[model samples]
Target: MIKIITKVTLAVLLLAVSVSKAQNFQGQAFYKSKTNMDGSLKIESSSMTEEMKQKFMESMKKEFEKEYILTFNKSESVYEEEQKLDAPEPSAGGMMIKMENSNDGKIYKNIKDKVSITEEEFFGKEFLITDSLSTYQWKIEGESKKIGEYTCYKATYTIPVSEKEKEEYANFKNKQTDSKTQFLMMDEPKEQLISVWYTPEIPISNGPGEYWGLPGLILEASFDKTVVLCSKLILNPKDKLIIKVPKTGKKVTKSEYESLVQKQMELMNSQRGDGKDGIRIEVHR
Candidate 1:
């Protein structure tokens, strides 16, 4: 009995040491994130041919094809974009269409303390948005897939769409009654089902962007018209990285930050009120 007890104690010590080593190291993950435009783009220009329009759409698609890096330890993570060379500016005829993508900000999450902070820059000003970490009710499915060397399991959640946005999209689609305009109507749902693939081999309850709280590290996520896939992962490199909280912007709650952004967008729209000058404020979720 004493020999068996000694063996069990030694095994437990070895397990503890391995877990400590695994949790203390830092890791980096590369992701390619692409989000499609919510509604079909309608550009009414007599100077543009169908081929020109197609080229313009391709350019627009390239705009959203972005790369991001997620640097993480056991309890905290920082997710930000990887900068690339700028493409030539797209030329639009007859009108200036202005839009905003709120997802360009940097996000930091600390799962140990249940806290999150995002540094957002808008029109030259930066704001720090502080809030609680997001809690997702992810339903794990029996399905499995492989992303690189790790096998990932499927999980999903849902995001409900608002009625006002639905009405606005419907109106935009039906406004093609004019003789000079052509509109393409599409069927959009009231809720978007978000899916993710996670691997328990890298056992950290974190992921890229505003997603986390799984039993493992999320390797890929799909939602709305966007898909964020992990292209590469490096664990425990030669040089260690510092994972710290963000603290460079005006501090505010998440709701307060969103309200301020809405007001600023409204002011900009009113200032640029012109028939040919169109301003559209888009906040991607």
Candidate 2:
């Protein structure tokens, strides 16, 4: 009994040490999105924290969940329509974040509400959009540079929409005439590119938008010229952050969600000054 107890104690101590090392540091990240000439969007994400890792880990869950609504200036439009900003369009559909210190450690998570077009749930639906919207291969190219005190690397990718893609886009537009659903449409592809600057210094693989799996942290990223940034990075916070995913809104996949929104928009357009934009449909299990 004594020998067995001693072995368990040693194993527990080793496990604790390993976990401590993993959560010992934290950093900040910034991301941006842009459009290429070919009707696709690009994204970049960077990490920008130097000495403080814990503070960032603690508050990051809450900070990253906050939305940054963006609007395009008409004068700044690359395409004539791109400049005609009608409303706040979503760049990052919605995000679900889960942070754990250890495999079984406490989890901090947050799920934001996506603006629902139909009263449908979007929780587990696979996004209708494909990674094919943009085709760009990126490679970590050259020595690291400093951005706001943290070292970052240069990674580049280019997106091009071909002739076949254009034909397919035309087909989708043909369906928009009297259709109640709004499918993903690509009108032009002249400005689609994604560039990223990251640092493997922090040792974590996560960032805003679809940027992830880098060796270090992402500090600054840009997709075309639309930018998302980590305005601040905190490290070694005295308190551990606790996050709970919210279940208040309907869940849908990215493409389906977009489709639902289009349906609602067309419905509203048809009603035009009649003033009936709120209709609720509930599903009972």
Score candidate 2 by lDDT.
0.40
| Candidate 1 ranges beyond 4 A from true positions | 1-6, 37-39, 44-59, 85-99, 161-189, 277-285
Candidate 1: deviation at residue 138, Å? 0.8
Error of 2 at 221 (Å): 1.2
lDDT of each: 0.77, 0.40
RMSD (Å) per prediction: 5.0, 17.4
lDDT of 1: 0.77
After TM-score superposition, what is the CA distance of residue 272 in candidate 1 from its true location, in Å?
A: 4.3
* Ten-residue stretch with the least lDDT total in model 1: 176-185
RMSD of 2: 17.4
Pairs that collide, model 1: none
Cα lDDT tens digits, model 2, 172-248, are 46645654423122344454666677766656654444444456655666764345554445443455432222233
lDDT for position 230 in model 1: 96
Per-structure clash totals for the candidates: 0, 44
